[model samples]
Target: MAFKVAIFDWDGTLVDSVEHIAESLHQAATELGFPALERNAYRNIIGLGMVEALDMLYPGLSREQMTSIREGYARYFFAKATMPQNVFAGMADVLADLRTGGRGCAVATGKSRRGLEKALLTSELGQHFDLTRCADETRSKPDPAMLAEIVAFYGIEPHEAVMIGDTVYDMDMAQRLGMPAIGVEWGVHDREALGQFSPRAVVGSVKDLRFALGI
Candidate 1:
C-alpha cells in the first residue's frame, strides 16, 4: 500500500546540525565545571531530547544542575544561529513531491517545541509538514507515542505511514507501532549501526531516500 503519511526526524536526518549540537553540549558541560565530552559522545545522544540527553551524558547530576546545563546549552546553541544549518540536498524538492503525490509530511523530533519551531521557521520548511510533534510534547523516540499520535491524527493505520530517520530510536519506534521505517546514512548514526534495527532500506543520500520512498 502507498504511504499516506511520512514522518521525519529533524536534527541529523533533515538538517546538518550535529557540529552545532556537539558544540553547545560541550559548552554546557564546561560552563557547569564538568568535563567536556568528545564530539562522538554528543553525537551518540543526538536523537534524544535535551533533558534526556543531559541525563544520559551526566548521569547522577542533581535536578538543579540538569536545569542549569539545559539552559546553558540552549543559550550556546541559539547564540550560534549565524552558523549554517542546511537541509540535506534535494530534501525540499522531495518533500514537495511527496505532498504533491498526496502524502502528508510531518516531523517527529527530539527537539523541544520551541527549538523545533525555530528550526522550521529558519529552514522555511514548516510549510511542507502537515503536523509536527516534539519530544517535550510527547514521549521520546523508541516509545512510539509520537508516531502513534501522528497516525491517529491522520486517521490512518500504522502501515499507512513511514518513519524516516537516522537513529535506531526512529526505527525501533516505527517497528513497535507496526510501521515501516527508512534509515538515512548522512545523519549521526552509521548504516551498519542503524541496520541492527532492520530498516526497510538504509539509504546513503537524499537521492537514495527519494528512491526508497518512491517520491
Candidate 2:
C-alpha cells in the first residue's frame, strides 16, 4: 500500500492469454518442423522474451531457425483474435485506479515492441500505463535492468515500486533489486514455485491481488 509505482507483466498477469500463447508457440514449432512439446513446456517459458524463450525450449538452435520461429510465432499469435476481453477480470479497473490515484503504472514485459503494440491496440488498455518497456528494448526478465529503467523514469527508488507478475522471472527480477514483488498464481507458476523467491506475497486471485496492492 505504500508503493508509488505499480509495474505489471503483460501475458498471464494482465491477460488470460496463457493457453492462446502456448497453442501459438506449438503451432509455430510444428510449422518449423520442430517437435512441438506439451502446453506446460511452453507455459514455463511464458514470461521470457521470444528468442530467450525459444532458446530455453530448444537450445543450440541455429540463428535461421530462431528467425523462423520468431516470424512463425508472431504470425500464429496475431492470427488468433486478441480482443479487449482477453484482459483478466478487474485488471483494467486496477490499472485505472492506480493511474487515478497518481500512482505510476508501467509494464515490464517479455513481449516484443511490436507484440505489445498490437496487444495495446486490440485491448485499448494502453492508456492506463505511464510507461512500458518491451524485452526487445532492454534486457529480458529474470534480469532487473528493465525494472531499473522503469523506476528511474519515474525518479523513484526500487522499493517504491511493486512488481505484479505470474512467473519466477518476475520475482527474480524484483529480488535482484531488493524490490517488492507480488506473484499471481494464475499464470505460469504455482504458489510453491513462486514462494521460492521470497516475494512480498503470492496471490491466488484478482481480489487477493487487489488487496496486496491496496487498490
Candidate 3:
C-alpha cells in the first residue's frame, strides 16, 4: 500500500547544509574562544539542534558559555546559513512527485523555526511540504516527539507514515513509533552508521528514495 504521509528530516536529507552548519558552529566556537569543531565532529551531530550541537562541542564549558555560544551561533548561522545550502539533487522532484501522487509531506527537524523556514524557502522547496515540526516546538531528534506530533496532526497511524532521513536519530524515532524509515546515504551519516539503526531501507540518492518508498 502507498504511504499516506511522508515525514522528512531537514539538514542532510533534503538540503545539503552540512558545510553551512559546520561553519556556523566553528564560528561560534571561535567567538567563545573554544576549540573549533572539525567537519567530522559537526557531521556526527547533524541531526541535533543548534543549541544541542554547541553543548556537545563545548562540553566542558559552563552553562553560561554554552548559552553565549549558542547565541553567537544563531547570529552567525542565520546570517549565512542559507548560502551554502541547496536542495539535494532530485529531492525537490521527488517531493513534487509524492505530492502529485496525493501523499502528504512534512518535515520533522531539529532546526529552529526560523532556520527551517530560511532553508526551505531559500531552496524553493517549501511549497511541497504541508507541515513542519521545528526544534522550538518539539523535543530534539532521537526523541519521538516531532514524529509523533506529525502523525497526530495528520490523524494517521505510525504505519501510515514513513520518515525519510540521513541520520540514526531519524531511524531511532521511527523505531520508537514503530514506523518505517528510509535512510539516505548522501547525507551526513554513512551506511555503517545508518545500518546500526536497521532502517527499512538505506538509499544512496534521492532518486533511489522513490523505489525505497515503493512508488
Question: Which candidate gets the maximum lDDT versus the true structure?
Answer: 2
Point out the worst 10-residue segment of candidate 3 by lDDT: 80-89
Candidate 1 residue-wise lDDT at 98? 94
lDDT of 3 by residue, 1-215 (tens): 36899999988888888777788778877876787666789778878876676667666777788788778878887886453337777888888888989999999998889888888777888899889998778788888998888999999999999999988888888898888899998888888888787788898966678888766
Reference-based TM-score, model 2 = 0.98
The C-alpha lDDT values of all candidates are: 0.88, 0.92, 0.83
Q: What clash pairs does model 3 have? A: none
What's the lDDT for residue 120 in model 3?
A: 77
lDDT value for model 3: 0.83
Residue range 20-107, candidate 2, lDDT tens digits:
8999899988987999797899999998988899999999999999999888888889886668889988899999988888898999
Candidates arranged by lDDT, highest first: 2, 1, 3
TM-score of each: 0.96, 0.98, 0.93
lDDT score for residue 183 of model 3: 91
Q: Who is ahead in TM-score, 2 or 3?
A: 2
Clashing pairs for model 1 are none
TM-score of 3: 0.93
Per the 3 Å backbone cut-off, how many clashing residue pairs does candidate 1 have? 0
Show where candidate 2 strays beyond 4 Å: none
Q: What is the lDDT of candidate 1?
A: 0.88
Model 1 C-alpha lDDT per residue in residues 67-157, reported as the tens digit of each score: 9998998898887542224887788888899999989999999999988888888887899999999999999878999999999999999
Candidate 2, clashing residue pairs? none
- Model 2 lowest lDDT segment of ten: 75-84
